[model samples]
Target chain A: MVEYKDGADFLSPDPIETQVLQGSQDSEGVELMVKKNNDRLTGWVSYTLSRSMVLINGLYEEQKVNGGVPYPSNFDRPHSFNLVANYRISRRLSFSSNIVYSTGRPVTLPVAAYYAEGRPFLLYSARNAYRIPDYFRIDLSVNLEGNLKFKKVAHSFWMLNVYNLTGRSNAYSVFYEVEDGAINGYQLSVFARPIITLSWNFKFGNYNSN
Target chain B: MNIQHTYKYTVTKLFPGGVRPKMHLWVVLIIALAVNSCIEPYFADIGDEPELISIEGSIIKGLSRQEIVISRTTSLGNPVFEPVKGCLVSVMDELNNEFVFDETYNGIYTLEIDQSSLVEGRNYKMVVVTPGGAHYESEYEILESSVPVDSVYYDIEPSLDPVNGIEADGLQFYVDLLAPDTVSRYFRWKITETYEYTSAGPIHYYYMDLSFEPVVPDDIWGLYRCWKTDELEDIFLTSTLNLATNEKKQIPLNYVSTLNDRLKIRYSLLVHQYALDEEAYNYFMQNKIATEGSGGLYTRQPQQPITNIYNVDDASERVLGYFWTSEMTSRRIFVSKLPELDVKDYFYPLEIFNMEDHGAGPFPMAIMEEDGVRITGSPICFDCTRRGGTTERPDFWE
Candidate 1:
């Protein structure tokens, strides 16, 4: 039995006055996993399909929000899949990689405009009415081990990582502005390029065995 | 399910196969850099915003004619309005005296009220019946006594925005109110500006009507002088509710930069002052913050204003506005010259024309002059009325 809940709802585009509204939250999900382990290679592929929804309306006044109706929460990403693989080429060198993809977060937007008494105003939809762009990225890493000597006191390895190998410009936010008598939107993203990092790690007990 | 065995390793119980992520997977997670997108700005593509009704109006104590504007919102980024017509609107007093409003124009309703019936201390409310038969009403508001304006004037000062570190000299207008009564004294100002402008001179050349070529004299062409009035939209509010003495002095009203033509010549600024209670004062301040912000809530989160108006049948229906009642007192001031400020010169493109330039058969022609520069071109350069101005001077003009 699903139970109702209580939260704040802001539907009008001014002051952002939070009104007490009643609603319910529900979520359902499915997961799939594939793991391959052997002497030469070890990798895992995990996929998930999930739905997160929130329904909020004032029972007395019928205030439509949290979203006017059922809506996705800020962190509701319906489809997420992650792939990881590590291939041992030689006793000293190995290659590891990953591919990650998921839906973006929900964002609120003003879809219309009006002017009263010569002062311009905007009209907004339900809270978190739309979403940003989906996110996709791939990464690659290489591990090189030092010469193996069991009698030695310590051992070391060099790890090289290349992030966002595809250079996909994932959108963090979408903002609107009126220019030249038209509404123009621009997407803001924190990282749109590839990044590489290298680190030399060591262990005292020669525990770097893969 | 072997619960007892898996319970020993509680962390692995979350997954179906109890597959724990290995250490190599954690080492591959490295991300985030300075993002760069080569895409240009695009018109936002999204669903439509719901159409809502907007209403605004007020009734003054001594004013005879009161008007209300009812309109609907348009598409995104397009502020052009669509009038909501065929609605019944009226105001009812506590004494049961109902003053009806008729749609004189598109979405504009007006009423001619008997000034005597607008008695102070009477409670008044507005009732609107939409075309869909939905009824709405505003909470009753008592007509408070208007506080008299002691003085209205302007001073030359530098525009200082300390936050942005900006400084520039401009004209700043202010108002002073008389001492408040024992009750709270809250005030808001509506500034109406009327200015007098002139044509280049008289009728330069009359080639239109072939009769009585140049019948009117240069100074008496009825086009030499005209007046235009405009109601500014900036909301200004002040109150003495939380003060020790409850006095208002030099309350800043409106600021005018020297770049515009508002103070170029003879100008009048009429301050329509409304005395409201603390509740209504707070409501108007909310709108003031919203109306003055960038994009008016478009860039920010949505917030519902706590208004006094509500639906009669359904509490869910939201009508966007406040139907206010107050005793309004107004004061007018004239500004003819600002010798201390350098105003930008007006640019008028005037060209020379003659009857021989088109058809040679016109009888007489008159040349118009401005600062001894004589030229004849379009009627706009010769008649102030060609622009949106009236030849009849306002009766209140000094």
Candidate 2:
């Protein structure tokens, strides 16, 4: 069965306030998911094997100005994938893990540079001028809960493992600072922050059956 | 039973040859479709941008002129405005009569036309010569307007409102309709006044008229504020009517009695009917009045000008007519002359033309403070008049 579904914020302009479109035909791929059976062994897979682009107002050989085009704001990427799964090992314990992979984001890099108004505003090259490297990450977590004896008490434990598998760096922006004369790329990245946490809680409740 | 040998040979060829040919054809078709397709799912890499073309022009018809600005589109198919310079933007009639646009300042240009040049049925077009040698043009028709004002007059009586103190209430000009009537008509007015500075020796004369009406009273009064630093000029006294009305109105020129005192007031009104967008009309009006008081007179010439509407007027221009009024200090009786002459400017010389006589006072005038310039007795003399114009200086007396 094919069905059209509107997300909770389908009509909103900026759902995440990120000032970026979630998907577009000439820019990036969007994905949907299916759930089978129960929460157990439930996993999602999404891949953006496509691209999106912005045809800027004045970013062409015939439209260069000191103050670049009207923000062509490029959002392009291909081959994005996300997989997550949860498995119940016993009546009291469950484990979950998730994996994400996506192609690099597009960015504009200036070629030749000039000073204007004594500030650094870019005269961007064409549109999606450059691409950052790909990104990948995996995370896992486990939870345990049980009822205790004639006292009518329950206990729960949660353990989370962030960046459980591979360690990687995701690039966000790259620019050059003119000191002396040499032009070099100054890379900025979101490094993997590997972490783990454990929490325990006790509760008292009536285990009533009807 | 005898056909066994023949069947074996046929089966062999059918199994391999027929299936293989079909499979090969399908593979080749799929490959061609993919190769010819220009629709890539991936975005193409864009390159650097190049310089854009700039187009500059203006709208000029009758007493109205507005700057026309637009830019060219990019490869991304979007329009972008440019920092334009050195262009001959002008308007020409079919008679080959043209006004070369002077780049008075930035993208702004000017072309003045008198009422005569604006015929009821003549056509006008604006042409622009770009810095890069490109020409662009747009045309419009001239629209003539009927007289907006039936009449203007002053209140025969003084103000009774004591809040304003003893003073002249003012003159009011009433139109035939409510202001900004559905049918828009542009109008203007001017006022001329002469005041004696000191001992009736030097008469400081002032003259101003609205380029179009209803006039912005604040802008007009602002000029007075600049000239006389001590007191705030009362702008509310001057008003404009956008529509038509039969009611008579007044324009008050409150008198200021000083050690160097003499006063006279005069004003005129002009109106035109023209089709204009709200912004364009507002801009034209604002620039006209604001530019006038600040500095720079718009005159006829191709040289440097303050605004584009200079020299646009001509003789025999049938516009809303002008009005004039005058006041002389000589014709008045005072309180001291009550028995013998009782003439107005004679005794309490200041009270003759004041609004209180007409019952318009607690003058509706603003409260001003003393600058330690003491007033001992009958002659309320201050070292410095609060309105900033002072009698202390010899030059002020003249």
Candidate 3:
């Protein structure tokens, strides 16, 4: 199925703190998925290819972003692949795993520098012309169920989850800042390390009978 | 028990903490998720942008010297423009006649052609040979006859400038054109304005000798008054195809603020009209839209306007600019002061000054006066030549 969406946002740069920029985003994409359910190994794989662009022409020509060209939207990732699998090891234990891969998000980068009015300024490439590194992550989790008993008032299951099993530092964003009359680029990753979580899911009133 | 009551009780029992309190946590999580969205800088490898040749010129009938400019586009970061020099340029008609152009300035070429040789309704084209041995030519353009302007006049009207907002007193200039009898015509106009202005102060008396004793009155040589002329840069195009009548009335050319110095004294405007073919008209119309449509919420996609000129050797090589032949008609009008229009009180008051020959040198000092007293300031103020215009009158000046 084909889909179309429109969105708007308010952006403010540091120099013009009071100046709020109004930008519009347009996105169109298609998705496809294949699933094998009710089998020994239940799994589903999906892929999506899409393009999104943002036009921030601003109220005046001077405030135009990306020289008024429609740049790639922040969420625009042309290609994405996702695989989710769940396999039952036994009646009491089950395993689930997920793998995700997608093209990196768009970012505006500086291509060159110049001096104007005795101050150094960076000339940026077209808005969103470059992207962060491609993103890939894998997650795994195991579910352990308690033994069934007719007299028990409640039964519980424990889940052990490992987020970002490989601890890959997928870049959340790449940023540039002017320092010492020069522009410097840096990458920032929100989830830079693996995380583990343990949780108990409970059912009341002899729910195991079903 | 009622189903609604049962559901409500179950929800309350499921969350010992009231639903409202638990919902607050969910709201916070959502807000955090939204705030966590980030923006970063990235380097895009767009590769090398091709530098293409840019040619700008026109072939007008009856012109002694036709001028053309050739330059190359630069990369995004560099603001400097590179002009193409030492190129062979020529204009040729279908009758095998050729007019060659000589490079006068950087990237600028000029040709002196016989005005009698330019015939109306004859097809003409421009050819250029680059220093790198590339040949370029434009499509043949027929010189169309132009209609004379019926009148050029100005009216005081209230108007709004998109950039500066409502201007209550504006002098709007308009052109009236007589309709062609049979064929539909496209019209393009160019406006040139010349205005007289004076410097701050007119030097009335000066010391003829270096000695402090001799002061002589200077003769009135019209040194205070000068004139400056400039051509308008905006593109203006109108066509009679959509109008019911062949005659177009009061087509607006430009507007001047009542407070503007151009209207303070005497102003003259020269309006040139050209008749264009359908293709040339379309090209100019698109050019007008592209330039005038900027600084607004709606903007046309940034693309080069298709030019008639193309590379003769390599069809893939992109060329910029248009070459077309058109018959042109011109009209001039002079405007004096209008007492009927109400304008804001604005004036540059002159200051009186005294000069002394101190043994070291001669120095001028400002002489203060009462608030209502009017006195001329220094020569820099009243001298017209300081403003970059000559005291000599133009041949066509009325």
Which candidate has the highest DockQ of all? 1
- lDDT of candidate 2 vs native? 0.37
Clashing pairs in 3: A174-B41, B179-B246, B199-B381, B199-B382, B200-B381, B200-B382, B201-B381, B201-B382
Q: State the local distance difference test value for candidate 3.
A: 0.70
Q: Name the docking class for model 1.
A: incorrect
Q: Which is the winner by TM-score between candidate 2 and candidate 3?
A: 3
Candidate 3 residues lying further than 4 Å off, grouped into runs, are A1-43, A48-80, A85-210, B1-44, B161-166, B182-184, B203-223, B296-298, B344-392
Cα-based lDDT for every prediction:
0.72, 0.37, 0.70
- The reply for model 1, stretches above 4 Å from the true place, is A1-83, A87-97, A101-103, A125-130, A138-169, A189-210, B1-48, B159-170, B204-221, B294-302, B350-366, B369-374, B377-380
Cα shift from native, residue B365, model 2 (Å)? 32
Compared with the true structure, model 2 gives a TM-score of 0.33
Which is the leading candidate under lDDT?
Answer: 1
lDDT tens per residue, model 2, B87-170: 777667657767666665655555554545554445566665666765555434343232333343332233343454545433
List the lowest-lDDT window of 10 residues for candidate 2 chain B: B320-329
lDDT of each residue in B1-398, candidate 3, tens digit only: 99877766776776676676457556656556533534444444546755667677778875567888887755434534467899999988999799889999988899877778788889999999999998999999988877777899988887766666756687899999896655447889988988876654444444333453433334444575778888887677888887777788889998887655777777899999888887787767655654455433222222234478999988877666678788778899998877876644335455443333223333332222346443444445556676668887788777
Across B1-398, the per-residue lDDT of candidate 1 in tens digits comes to 49755553554444347455343224433331323444434344474456767777777785789888787767865767788899999999998889899999998899999889888888998888889897888889888778767799999987765456656566788998776565447888889988887776666445445442544454546677889988888888898877777577899988876555556778888998888877678667766756665543343346444457778998877667667778888899998868887654445556654435624533344456556654565557666887788999999998
A69-183 per-residue lDDT for model 1 (tens digits): 6778767889999999999999889999999999878876666666566566666555666778889999999999988777667789899988888877778678776677656
Tens digit of per-residue lDDT, candidate 3, span A1-210: 111111111231234333335668789999999999996689999999999887767554434665567878778899999999999988788999999999998765555543211122234445567788999999999999887676787888899988888877788767555455445566777776666778998887453655
